[model samples]
Target: MPFERVRLERVRLEPWKRRPELAALALLLGLLMMLHSHIPNIAGVGSLVESLLPWFGVYVPVLLAGALWRRSPSAVVALVLPVTVWLSLFGGLLTDKSHPGGDLTVVSHNVGAGNSDPSGTARQLALSGADLVALEELTDQARGTYEKGLAKAYPYHEVRGTVGLWSRLPLSDTRPVDVVQGDVGPLARTKPPESAAEAAAEVRALRTTVATEHGPLAVYVAHLGSVRVMPSQGFWTDSRDFGARALTKAVAAEPNQRMLLLGDLNGTTDDRAFHGLTSRLTSAQETAGNGFGFTWPAAFPIARIDQILVRGVRARSSWVLPETGSDHLPVGARVSW
Candidate 1:
């Protein structure tokens, strides 16, 4: 009876030799599940999956090599589904830059707190000729340097907390926005300044009206609270989620239809936590950029946390600028009114 059981187990294992194509197909199906992140959102793993969704296309090359080695037409055929799905989702972005000529150009960057050359970074950004520049992670030490460096190009600017906005056009009605809830830090408590010049020193998120050629445009600059992944606690997105909810509510209540939001949201559009903002506004890069345009960890950008989102206005083109002193690469978008 023991010998018979061993023979049955060996027979089951040997099926791959007889039908390798079927086995490959099964593997492809599993890959498909991972590609779509069909798994449940248990303990916040689902958000992680969505964050890495674009990279799943990396598997296609490996699968193709396996199909060739096995000489299995069935295995090759099985790859078509994933290929189609991937192409359907990201193919347009791989194509050439089609749209051009924008009424306004906007740039956003999270100049790392450890940035070595704040003035140089500011100069580079100012040279981009962006009508508006939004910066996050602004430190007290580097703030004055950036302000001085950019003063020539961007005469009008505002900073609230760690986030700031610089514009070539006139700005008005600028006020600190309450995005993050819970522990209200010193960053969030900006005293009402007696003058416009000192107003930004204390602000984290700000809503300002930009006077454009077309009309007044509402622009919101924010640096949402960061998130972390801990072995014991899982994805720690509580602060980010809270800020998202608050920002969403503020944007929803805005009377202006032509609004722009630029900053380091610290979460991807695919993450459900950002649906509050994504559902209302359109991402500039997703709408018009040529490629993935990832813009974090400047050395090797794996994700795009910095964003340019617009409502009513149209994004003509969106792209990432060259590397800077900061850890995050700057992202820019050209929009038409």
Candidate 2:
């Protein structure tokens, strides 16, 4: 009887010993992920991993609960660090409630370059009742279609590089923004354009001032270069990193007090790469959105790359519009002075 009791005690303590190590590992991973923003050029791999980090917060608590139930006090304590960090980063999301209050309506859409149905996409965007519409990935072929389709509703419009802004109000001072492209090393300069037309197509970043009823709102529409993952390289986001930095500098230099940036940032607001932009602006969705507001791959959006950010204006309500023909869904926000 004594031997059996001792064996049972050992079995019970075995799980406790393992729990500490597991808990420690989880804590370490969580910390690394949290600090991922500090590591440069992680766009390819880091960005992808970071996109999923918010989900880990869900499992960490459950694991800690299990540890506590098993009477592992040390393990429970180990969990505290990660739990605190995660909550600090994402806790605000818990209290977000949709409240309607603004006067101006704005929309942002990526309208994938490869979209097969530009007309359908244009029609859907026009119906959103937006006072201002900003579009990215505006390839030459689709520009005319968009201009013609949207002209009926938005009489004032401007296109710079591959991005465009259409407004119910007049738009002026439109120009291309010079976002840094990664070091193609000497190769890019020397590599002749595939054709003269391809060389002209190179122009693709733009900014414009929308003359809203309230005043002139500086609007920036940009598409950061895409990030790619590779086995040997780990991650490749240098182009996006450079572009984001340049854009940040430009926004900082702008003379206007009120600013609105709408586009497919190629990153989430949570991404550190966007710290420059996020630090200066406020996300409309977090203030008045009802849900996560994911707006990519229209089939099922797990992440939000399309966004509407504002400064000097209050967000009344924000939401994603129904899918058009593009891969991304449209995002709309109501704002006021």
RMSD of each: 6.8, 3.9
Worst 10 residues of 1 by lDDT: 181-190
Tens digits of per-residue lDDT, candidate 2, 232-295, equal 6666666667778888888889899898888887777877678898898888887778767888
For candidate 2, what is the lDDT?
0.78
Off by over 4 Å in 2: 1-18, 38-49, 61-73, 180-200
Clashing pairs in model 1? 159-200, 160-203, 160-204, 161-202, 161-203, 161-204
| lDDT score of residue 123 within candidate 1 | 93
Number of clashes found in candidate 1? 6
Most accurate candidate by lDDT: 1
Residue 255 local lDDT, model 1: 98
Can you write out model 1's per-residue Cα lDDT over 1-337, one digit (the tens) per residue?
6999999988667532224665466466546544555666666677777777778778777777776666656666777777777777678778756397989999999998999999899999999999899999999899999899999999899888788899999999998887754524323334456775555553568899999989999999988877777677687666677788889999999999999999998888877888889999999988888888899879999998888999999999999999999999999999997
In the predicted model 2, the residue pairs found to clash are: 162-204
Off by over 4 Å in 1: 1-38, 183-203
